[model samples]
Structures are given as structure tokens and as C-alpha cells.
Target: MSHAHDLVPFFEFHLYGKEQIPDLSNLPEPRLFSTHFLFHSLPDSIAKSKCKIIYICRNPFDSCVSVVFHQCNCTIIITQIILEEALERYSEGINEFGPFWTNILGYWRESIETPNKVLFLKYGDLTGDVTFYLKRVAEFLNCPFNSEEEGNGVIENIIELCSFKKMKELDVNKTGKMVGKYENKVFFRKGVAGDWVNHFNPWMVEKLSSVIEERWVWSIFLISLSNTYISIMA
Candidate 1:
């Protein structure tokens, strides 16, 4: 998902969504772009550039649920796709623009290897403390909040603007269209971090947990995220 994507002021495109030619690369200093491409598949120019990348990873449970909801709604006609099928595809990394593990772990690994260049944030942590992370984001992008900006409540204003309650109610989001397949309104589903709990049955939950263990257990990706202070504090 592109659920909270609207808050990012200037992403050229959601690379995971449609295969449109992105007009992003080589724009200037501090251009923002979003992508689901694995580290191996990322365009050579971007990987080699001095650009900073902010990649957010949601736990597989929630990511899978969100993608399922998104797929069900984006269809033109009613389809009875089941949770089991979605979970199976997700675990196998067979979903669109996936293997989900590859997309996630590739960034996770890069963020570990090049912490300064890739600021990896967890979706749960970000929504939990937008103020702190927003400040971190600004600082990472080299436009940190100064004393003057702090006094002006710039951080608070930015927090309120991107808050779920505020963003979901905006008229532009209520009506705007993107990439033709996704209606903007559909993107604003319940943004709670562990929303997967409400939808996943016991078997589905077990399968994802197993997949997570098998795929990430030995990987330094999530484990090493602590080095950059982007992962949650103990």
C-alpha cells in the first residue's frame, strides 16, 4: 500500500502499482520517490546515486491483509477470492510485483549495509510516533526543523496534516483518482498497525508466521535494523 502515500509530498509514482515510466530519477537533490523494486532490480543510476532512500516495512501479516483488501476493491466485478488464497500467494511471494519477502528483505539488507543512504522505518513505529519520526525524516532529508520552525509549530502542523483521521477525511482524497485502477478513497482503509488480526483466521496466521520464520529467521535484515535506530527501541 499506498494508503498513507498521500502524505509524502512528492513521490513520482508508486513503482509497485502500475508499470508507468517513472519521471523521478536525476531530478535534483532531495527528490522523493517510492518503489517496491528489490535492491537487485533497482535501476543502476538510483542505486549508485547519492540519493537517500526512505523505505518503510510493515510486518508481513498486515501487509498481506492490506494487499488483499486492495485487490478485492480494485476489481470491476465482485470476486470471491478467499483469505487462504491470498495468504498462499503472499507467502510464495506470488502477489503482484512481489515476492513480498524479496521486496522487503532487499531493502532491509540495503538499509543495514548503507544505513546513511537508506533510512528504513517500520510502519508500526511511524504511525505510533509520527512526531518523532517526522523530525527524523526531515533531518534525514537535510531540512531539519530549526529553532524558528519549532517555535512556529511546524512539526505539529505536519503531524496533524498526515494524521489518519485528518488525511482520510480530506475532500481531495475522497475524490481523487490515481493510475485508474485505484480510487483514492479505497486507499484510506483502517490504517491501524495490526489490522491483520481482524481478518486473518488461525490457519492464515500460522502460515504467515511460518513463512516469516523460514524467510527472515537467518537474515540480518530485521535484526540489524537496530543499528540505525529505525527499528523499535527495546
Candidate 2:
């Protein structure tokens, strides 16, 4: 499944305080799951296991805008806040699963320390060249496509299947609620990088940029990383 909430009851409880957790032991091996939990918070078993972990970090400016839309759209979560208020919260690292740099840096450090066990990907780089990154993911998972598969357009087919436009149009995604009250459609916005530009004013840009700069001042790697991602979109 794409997300832990899609299968595991433990994750559902952890994320939304739901009491009913289903039995997942019967599921087959090589099961893939995704989560937003920080590295420090993940189960001990996951850390000890040989399973590969891929962490995708996004540009903070676009992340903030997307999160605000998610929170505001899900009325059951909290009272909807305006864009200005959301920007302020994001500047302070106050959103859900936030302290944003901490989350990114945690996995980043792990990826460096144990390169085989963890893969760090930037959302901008993935968007900029999806086929390259998709192959990277396949290789990382030990399932690299052969020349014949590539020649047969298997890679292209997978990309088309998972494209935001295609997935958003699926009946399963377009209909029904998830995690109790969240409409499935809320998860599918524009799905494009750099959308923050449309919502952010000069002041918003300055504020977030200053925060990112301050947060990454000591880490030359992060500064370079952020610059590379931003430049890709530019």
C-alpha cells in the first residue's frame, strides 16, 4: 500500500486515535508501506530489519502550501485557518509532523550513515526527471527493469498509471472517505511542484526563506541541497 493508513491499524491509531486495528499478519511478504513518522519514532523492528526505506523531502515553501490546503480541506481535523495564519505556523515549524527540518535531516543522516538501508530523494528532482528517479527506486528495491522491459514500455506504463492526473481520475480515489472524515479527493490537489508561488506573496517568500536560511545556516549540505532543488524548478 502507498501509505500505512491504507493498511495498518497501528498506524491508523497512531495518526488518528482510531481504536479498531485489523489483523495484518496474514499479508504476504515483500509488502511495501509508506508513513510520515519521523525516523526516531519508527518501530525498533524497522530499524533492525533489512527492508529498504525511501524518504522523499520536499521544498518547504511548497510543502507548507500543500499542508495548509490539506488541513483546511479536512474540516473535521481543525477549524480552517487562512493562508497567512498557515504561513506563520509553518515559519515556526508548528504544523503536524513538523519541525520540518528535523524530519528531513533525520532521514538524511540515516541515508548517509547507512546508504544501503535508506534512500533519500528530493521531490523536486523526482518531478524534474521522473523516469530517472523511478528507475532509481526500482534499483534501490532490487527490482531494476531489464532492457527488454524498458523496450516493451513497462516503465512508461507504470509512470502513466501512477501519474497524478490518472490516479485522481480513478473512482477509488475520487470517491469515499479515508481515516473517518477525510474525503479521498482532498489528497489529490494540483500535484505539481512550485505551487507555492501562486499562493505566496513577497512577504511570505521572505519569511519562509529567512526561516530556511536560519535553520540550515550551519549545514552546508542542506543549503546546497535546497539550492539545487529550488534551481531545478526555476
What are the per-residue Cα lDDT tens digits for candidate 1 across 1-234?
344554353233554345666554535644555666677877677887788988888988999878887887755432335777878888998965768777787887788689888888999999888888999989888889999999999899988877888888877777756655567877787888998887887888888889888887755555665555754453
TM-score of 1: 0.80
- Give the lDDT of residue 222 in candidate 1: 53
Across residues 170-216, which tens digit of lDDT does each residue of candidate 2 receive? 77777676766667788887888988888888888998899888876
For model 2 the local lDDT of residue 79 reads 28
Quote the RMSD, in angstroms, for model 1. Answer: 6.2
TM-score of each: 0.80, 0.83
List lDDT for all candidates, in order.
Answer: 0.76, 0.79
Lowest-sum lDDT 10-residue window in model 1 = 7-16
* Segments in model 1 whose C-alpha atoms lie over 4 Å from true places: 1-30, 74-81, 221-234
lDDT of 1: 0.76
